[model samples]
Target: MKAKVVALLCFLNLCWLLIGGGVFSALEWQHESAERVSFEDTRSRLLQNYSCLTEEEVTNFIRAIVTATNAGLTLDNSTASDTSNWDFGNSVFFSSTVISTIGYGHISPSTYGGQAFLVPYALIGIPLCGLMLNGIGENIGNFITKKKEQYKKRWSKKVSDRTAEVLVMLILFLLFLVFLVLIPSAIFLALEGWSYHISIYYSFVTLTTIGFGDYVPGQNSAQRVVYRLAILCWFMIGLSWMAVILNQVSTFLTDIGVKAQTAREERKKKKEGDVGEEGEENKAAEDEENWGSTKSAKQSNVELRNMTPIES
Candidate 1:
C-alpha cells in the first residue's frame, strides 16, 4: 500500500511538471523568438551605423554587460547609487530570500569569496529558516484544528467527522489564500504596476519558493527599503501559511492510503477465515462417512458368520 501511494504521488508530480512545462513554453516561446529577431536587427543597425565596430567586438561587449548584470551590478547611471544590489537594505532583502530558500535569482554574488561564503551561509540559514517556519506552521495548524473541532460539533448531526473536517479545511485554505495570497497579490499589483495575473503569478511562485526572478518587486523604486522589508515579512508569513496547508493535504492523503491498506488486510483475513471454516466442514463430513462405512462392513461380516453353519 505504501509503495502504491508513493508511485501515485510520483506519477502526479510528473504530470504536473509536464503540464507546467507545456503551458510556459506555449506562453513564452513566440515572445522570446520575436525578441531574438529584434535583437539581431538592432545589432545589424548598430554595425551599419558604426562602420569601425566589428560583430565580434559588439558580441563581447554585450556578453560583458550580461555577465555584470547577472552578478548584480547596476549599469544604469541614474539608478546605480540608490538601487544597487549591495546597498544595505537590498542586501537584507537578498539575505532574507536566500535563508528562506526563495532565491529569486534577481541578484547574486559577483566575487569568488562571496560565492564561497554563500555555500555555508545557505547551509546554516536554510535549516534555521525551515525550523522557524515549521514551528509557526504547527502553531497555525493547531489553531485550525481547534476551530475544526468546534465546527465539527456544529456539523455533527449533518455530516461525518471526516466530511466536517474537509469542509473546515477548505474554508481555512480559502481564508489563507485570500489574506496571504490574493490580497497580497493585489497590493503588489498596485505597488509594482504589474497586471493582475502577473501579480498573482508572482505571489504564488514566491510563496511556493519556485522563484523564477522574472518579475521581482521593488526593483525600479529608488526608495524601496520599506517595500523590501514588508515583502520579507510577507514571505515569512505566507510561506508558513502555505506550509500548513500543504501539510494538511499530505496528512489527508496519508490517511486515505492507510485506510485503504487496512481495508485490504481485513478483506484478506475474512477470505482466509471463510476458507478455513469450509475446509473444517469438509474434513468432519469425510470422517463421519468413513466411520459409518466401517460399522456397516463389520455388521455384514457378523451376520454372515451367524448364518455360516446352515449355509454350509
Candidate 2:
C-alpha cells in the first residue's frame, strides 16, 4: 500500500512538472504580442486559459529568458515565424534528446524565458538524478550488508570483526560517492560553461541538503514529463543513498569506540597483575597510570583521599 502511494505521488509530480511548466510558460508570455503561443503551447492549452497571464512582469520575465538562451539565434533558427522547416518533435526532442546528447540546433527557444528553463532543469536534475541512483544504491547496500551478515553469522564460530567489515564499507561508500555523484556533475557543469570546482561544489551542495535551488534541470518543457520524472526519481535516490552512507558511518565510529574501550581494560588488568608484589596503594596507582589521566586519576585521587583521615 505504501509503495502504491509513493508511485502515485511520483506520477502526479511528473505530470505537474510538465503541465505546470507549460501553463506557467504560456501565462508568462500572454502579455507579449496577443498573437499566439508556440505549437507545443497551443496544443497543450487548447481548452485552458492561455491568457491567464495578465501581469506584465511575468510576460517580460518569459521574454528575457528566451533572449538569453538564444542570444545569437538567427532569423532562421531563433524566431518562431521561421517555422518553414520545423521538426515534428522539435520541442520534445530539444528537451528529451538532451539525455542522448543529440541537441538539435534548430527550433531553439530563442527567448530568455526558454533559456531560463534549461538552467533550472539541470540544476534540479543532477542531484535529483543522483538521488534516484542513490535509491537503487540503498537497496543494494542493505542486500550487501545482509549477505555479509549471513555468511559471517553462519560461521559464527569465526571471530571476524564487524569493525573491520564496517571500515571496508566506508571506504567503498566514499569511492562510490566520488565516482558517481562528483564526477558526472563535474562533467556536465563544465560543459555548461561552469568552472570545474563549481561543478564539484554543486555536487556536494545537493547531497548535503543545502539545496540552494540555484541550479535545476528541464527549463524547456519539450519533454516535460520525462525531464520531471527523471529529476524527481534522482532526488529520491540521492536522499536514500545518503541515509545508507550515514548509517555505515555511525556504525564505523561506534565500532572504533568499543574496541578502544576493550583494549584499555585489558591493559589495566595486565598492569595490576604485574605490580602484585607492591602494596595495594601502589597497585591501584599503577592501574590508574595504565589508563588515561582523566577519569581514572580523578577517581583514584578520590579513593586515596577517603583512605586518609581529614586531619584536625
Candidate 3:
C-alpha cells in the first residue's frame, strides 16, 4: 500500500509538471506575440513622425537589433565585436545554470552546433547535478538523525521522534532561508545597486530556478568576471540547500504516511478478529440448542416406549 501511494504521488507530480510547463509555454508565446505587434505599431508611428528613413530600411535595422540581442552581441555599426557570452567566466556561469536547471536564458547558443551540443550536455549534466545534491542532502539528513539519537540517549528522557525530526527540519530550513536567500539578497543589493526588495526577489527567483530574466546580474557590470563567478557559486550552493530541505520534507511526509497506514491496518485486523469471535459464539449457541432438542426427543420416546411395554 505504501509503495502504491508513493507511485501515485510520483505520477501526480509528473502530471503537474507537464501541465505547468504547457501552460507557461502557451502564455509565453501569447505574450511574445502581443509584444511583437505592439513594437511594430510603435515603430510605424515613430517612422511616420520622422520620415527620415524608408520602411524597408527601418525594418532591416530592427531585424539587425534583434539579431544582435539574440547573439549576445553589441552593435557599433563600424565592426563586429566578440560577444561576452563565450568568455570563460560567463561560460562557467552558463554551465552552472544549465546543470542546475536555473537556465536564466539571458544568453543562448546561436549556432546550430552549439544548440545541438546543448541537448546532450543538459541530459548528462542535470542528472549529475541531481546526484550530487541528493548525496549532500542524504549525508546531512543522516548526520541530523545521528545527532538526534545521541541527544535522546544523553538526556535519557522520552522525546517524540516525530517532534525531533520536525524540529531538525525546521532548523535546516531556517538556515537555508538565511544563508541562501537573505544573505544573497543583501549581497546582490549592495553589489548590483538594486533596491532591497528587487534584490530579494531576484535571489528567490534564481534559487527557485524560475529565471524570469527580468533582471540579470553581470550584464553591464564592469566586474563581469567576478560577478558571474560569484553568482554561479551562490546558485550552486542554493540548489544544494534546497535539495536538502526537500529531502527532509519528503522523508518526513513519507514517515507520517507509513505510520498512518500501519495504524489503519492494525485497526482493520482488530475489527476482523472481533467479527470472527462473534461468528464462533453464534455457531456455538446454535449447537447447544440442537443438542437440547435432541435430548428432549429421546426422553419422550423412552417414556412412550415404557408405557407401551407394560400393556403388551
Query: All candidates: CA RMSD in angstroms?
Result: 2.2, 19.0, 4.3
Going through the candidates in the order shown, the clash numbers are 0, 32, 0
lDDT (C-alpha, whole model) for all candidates:
0.90, 0.60, 0.82
Q: Please give, for residues 20-130, the per-residue lDDT of candidate 1 as tens digits.
A: 999999999999999999999999999999999999999999999999888776688887665567879888899998999899898988789989999999999999999
What TM-score does candidate 3 get on C-alpha atoms? 0.79
Task: State the displacement of the C-alpha of residue 43, model 3, in Å, after optimal TM-score superposition.
Answer: 2.6
Give the lowest summed-lDDT range of ten residues in model 3.
Answer: 74-83
Model 2 TM: 0.38
Between prediction 1 and prediction 3, which has the larger TM-score?
1
Off by over 4 Å in 2: 1-138, 147-167, 182-187, 190-197, 273-312
lDDT of 1 at 239: 95
lDDT of 2 by residue, 1-312 (tens): 268758987999999899989998889767564555464475345425655665465558668767754542334445535432224433543453233222334345556987788787756765664566566767868876886576667655655667447545756577658765777566546444566677666656655556553543333345545655654454445556666777777777777777887899999988887676467778788888776667777897888877846541
Task: Please report how far candidate 2 places residue 23 from its true position, in Å.
Answer: 44
Please state the error at residue 104 of candidate 1 in Å. Answer: 0.7
lDDT of 2: 0.60
